[model samples]
Target chain A: MALTIAIHSYKGGSGKTSFAINLASAYASVGKSVCLLDVDLKAPSSFNYLLPEAKHWVNDIFEGRYGVMDVVKDVSKEMGTKGAFYVGYSNPDIVAVRGISSKDRKWQSKALKLLMTAKRDLSNAGIDIVILDTGAGVDFTSVNAIAVADYVISVGRPGASRQRLMEQVIGGVYMPLDKDCYIIENMCHNDNPTDLSGKKFDLPVLASIPCMCDVAVRCDNEVLVLTEPDHAFSKKIYDIMESLDKITS
Target chain B: MTDNSSTEEMIRLLREISGKLDRILIQGSADNESDDGILDVLDVMTLLTLPDHLRTTATALFELGSATADELAERTNKERAVESNYLNQLVRMGHVAKNRKGRKVYFSIGEGLGK
Candidate 1:
């Protein structure tokens, strides 16, 4: 079974999805069979950042026109055989899918089934890990994705709201599941070092990623982390992967 | 019903019900199993009267069990409390066991539960 890691945060704009894509790509660069699933149905940005191959299978799967595996394309081909990388494509109009009604019980049930199916397909494709990029906030979709993961990587920026959201998620959600959830502070400015420390945020800080405009611009252009490992952001992503390996192993 | 058909149907239903219950459990809802006496009732139900459908599914879930709440949460997208309660019920009923190594609670199917 592939280790399913869900990159999630309760608050938006915390670089959750971007970290998921970059981390998945980083793992792939090290010869790990990795698949990045864009489960953030309302805002599916992983496809735009790491798998902009102009073709995705998400629409096909949603419309009952294709299996999920048909859309798992190798985006790492451009990185020269460093490792295997595949992105599960999603339709840009995925919000229109009938199974996307977050409040509907039928939709929730169907979405869970879809997740399980996606996991099976990804595993069968020899993916060693599946990184799920979840939507922000404590919605049904995010909860369902986190519930089914082997590891929950809570990504957030250092802020009061972000810290509170992390506490709510970890205390109310992850703790019940008894999961090994780790917190990652992204886009940390050097001036604010005590942002997440002390009695306020008691959760372990797995890694801190510095804010890098160049990396953000490249991500906006749909670039992979391995494509520029020497970059500051890429190195930060590499450190996260290493930390994850240490904890998971 | 034929024995084979009944067994299959039971397993199917158990799988669906267990999946549903598993979702609720993963969400970290406070099931009324906190009282030791109530816990005993749940254990009896699980051991004796739990529908065949639920039995099969619960067995499968326990068998392919996660070692940590984090692992289970990562797999199910559920909150920690929900998963803990579900695992607690299983543990109380002797269907699951928790291995405490250092600070972590690793859950797996109990050896007593015939696999």
Candidate 2:
């Protein structure tokens, strides 16, 4: 069975998208067929990194103009992966973003159904995992991604306020949906300690990655997990994957 | 297409689904063996016909296969009474079947929702 994971956050600037991309890269490097979807339609930055070229974007799939297969692009050769790495990028144009964001509840409801169908299609294509890079907050897009996911990894910074926001979302959304949720304390400073124990939150803290100034400042779409496997940040990413395997298994 | 056109399209689809659901219910009512109202097989499109609140409940039930309201409550993080009402609503819609096994009431997809 293909496991669908949604990397989500209650707020932005928490390294959610980067973690999602690297997590997908890590799995592909290990010969697991993975499909990373840039479902954060309003702020699609995956295109800046993956630089995928396709005739159809993910926006086309939701609009009933095309299906998942029509937009899926394989970059296994480019990424030098033993397994296939496919991506379904969303259109990053301002007009496209506004259009998708302005969609009504009816359209969003239909979009959710389309997403479920897309999940099945990806699984049928032999994908081992499907990772959704979701937008922050309780928007329609985020909820749809959460609804279809088997697991959700919520990324947050180390702070009392951020922790409170994380707790509210977990209690209000993840708990209600009965999702398997894990927390990643991203960009933790030396002075600000992240509670690794599960008592801090209802879910387990998957990892507490410290602030690497050189890495945190780099604006490039460099996937350190694949390029620099020996790096401390990369090791933490792998550790997170190991923890996920144990829990899921 | 504009929002107006999209809204119109959604209405059209809902009408089509409603017609299909009506036919399924009537045929199921006639074919039911145990005299337990309409017993039918819901397909994937059934998800689209449900409202957001009911959709969430139905989705959880679909994942659980068959469960009591209390079991569904635990999974959905809703009160058992709320889940019971939702399950009853699904039963009325012929999308789910209700059974009494001992003292507990179990609700399951009518036949199967295409897995």
Give the per-prediction TM-score of chain B: 0.44, 0.61
- Candidate 1 off by > 4 Å: A49-56, A59-66, A94-99, A194-202, A222-224, B1-115
Against the correct fold, how does model 1 do in TM-score? 0.65
- Which sections of candidate 2 miss by over 4 Å? A196-201, B1-56, B61-115
Q: Which number leads on lDDT?
A: 2
**Model 2 has how many clashing residue pairs?**
0
lDDT of each: 0.67, 0.80
- Candidate 2, residues B1-115, lDDT tens digits: the string is 9999999999999999999999999988666532332234443334544676777788877666679999999988999999999889888877787999999999876753222
The ten-residue window of minimal lDDT in model 2 chain B covers B33-42
Error of 1 at A206 (Å): 1.2
User: What is the lDDT for A9 in model 2?
Assistant: 95
Instruction: Compare the candidates by DockQ and give the number of the best one.
Output: 2
lDDT of 1 by residue, A126-162 (tens): 8898988888887766776776687888888877655
What DockQ does every candidate get? 0.03, 0.05
DockQ of 2: 0.05
